[model samples]
Target: MKSIVILIFFLSSIIGLGQDYIFLESKNGFREIKLGTSVENYPEFNRKDNSNAELFKLSLNSKADYVYVGSNDDKIKTAKILFIYLTTNNNVISEIKVVTEKVLNVYAILNSAYGEPSSKHGDKWIWKTNNIECSIEGDQNTIPGYHIVYKDISNERIELKKMKLESTKKAQAEL
Candidate 1:
C-alpha cells in the first residue's frame, strides 16, 4: 500500500503538479474572461445558435438572468476545442463549460492552467478557491472527451437563492 501511494505521488509530480497559473485568472473564469464582469466586454462570443446536438442545447437563454454564450473560434491552449459555453448571470459571466477534442492533452493543459486539482473523485478532478470552483471530468454520455466546468461560487449562491425563493413562491401559490 505504501509503495502504491508513493508511486502515485511520483507520477503526479512527473506529470506536472503545481499552482503555477493560479494567480492568472480572475475568480476562475475562462482565460482572460472574468466571473463578475459583464459579457459586453467580450463581443467576440455570441449567443449560441439553435443546434441539434445535446451538447449544443445546454443554453438557457429563455431565462431572464442566465444565458449561455459560445464561440467557434475559442481554444483552451493550442487548438481543437470542441465546445466552449459561458453561462452568464444577468449578463455577467458566472460559469464556463468546455468540451475538448478527444485526442487533446487535457490533463497536462489543464494542469498548466489551473495547477494540480484540489481533489479528484473518480474521473472528475476539482479545483476550488474561496470564490471559484473548477472541475474537469471525463464524460462518455454526451461526448467521448473531457467536460470542464468553471464557475463563480458567489454567483452560484445568488442563483440558488433566487431558485429557492421561486420554489417558495410556487409552493405558497397552491396553498
Candidate 2:
C-alpha cells in the first residue's frame, strides 16, 4: 500500500509538470511556421486568396506575422488558412494560431501528432506539455470554423498582459 501511494504521487507530479504550458509539444506550425522559431528567423510563406485573408491581414497589425493561404469549398488550398505569430520574449514567435474549415480532419491530424489529449470539452480538445499548450476547437454554426492554437510559456507575455489589464481597469475606474 505504501509503494502504491508513492507511485501515484510520482505520476501526479509528472503530470503536473507536463501541464505547465499550452504549446510545449508543438513542433510544427502551419506548414513552415514551426514552434520555438524566432519571428525574424522564420521564412515567409506564399500568401494566397482566402475568405479569411482580409481578417488575417487585419490581425497583422498586432501580431508579428499573419499570412493567408486561399481556400476552395472549405478546403484550404495550401492546407492552411491562416498563420498568426505573436511576438513575445526577444521578438520570437511565442504563440501560433491556425484557422481551418475542416475541424475533424485537423483534430485527427493533431491527435496523431501529439498523442492523446489531456482534456476535451465539446468542440475543444487540449494537449499539454511542460512548456506548451495546444488546443483545437471549432464553431457550431452553419459555417463552422476550426482553430488550432499553440501557446508557449513566456514571462514577457504574462507581464505585458497584466500591464494591459491594469491600464484598462484604471481607465474604467476614472470613467
The top-ranked prediction according to lDDT is 1
- Which runs in model 1 stand beyond 4 Å of their true positions? 1-21, 24-27, 48-55, 58-74, 77-79, 139-142, 155-175
lDDT of residue 98 for candidate 2: 66
- lDDT for each residue of candidate 1 in 1-175, tens digit (9 for 90 to 100): 9999999988776444334534424445767767778878877665644552344543322222333333466555554566566677678877777666665577777777777778999778887765688888764455455777777787567789999999999999999
lDDT of every model, 2 decimals: 0.65, 0.60
User: Which residue pairs collide, candidate 2?
Assistant: 21-132, 21-133, 22-132, 22-133, 22-134, 23-132, 23-133, 24-131, 24-132, 49-70
Candidate 2 C-alpha lDDT tens digits along 101-127: 564567777776667788998868988
| Residue pairs with backbone atoms closer than 3 Å in model 1 (clashes) | none
lDDT measured at residue 126 in model 2 versus the true structure, 0 to 100: 88
TM-score of each: 0.59, 0.54
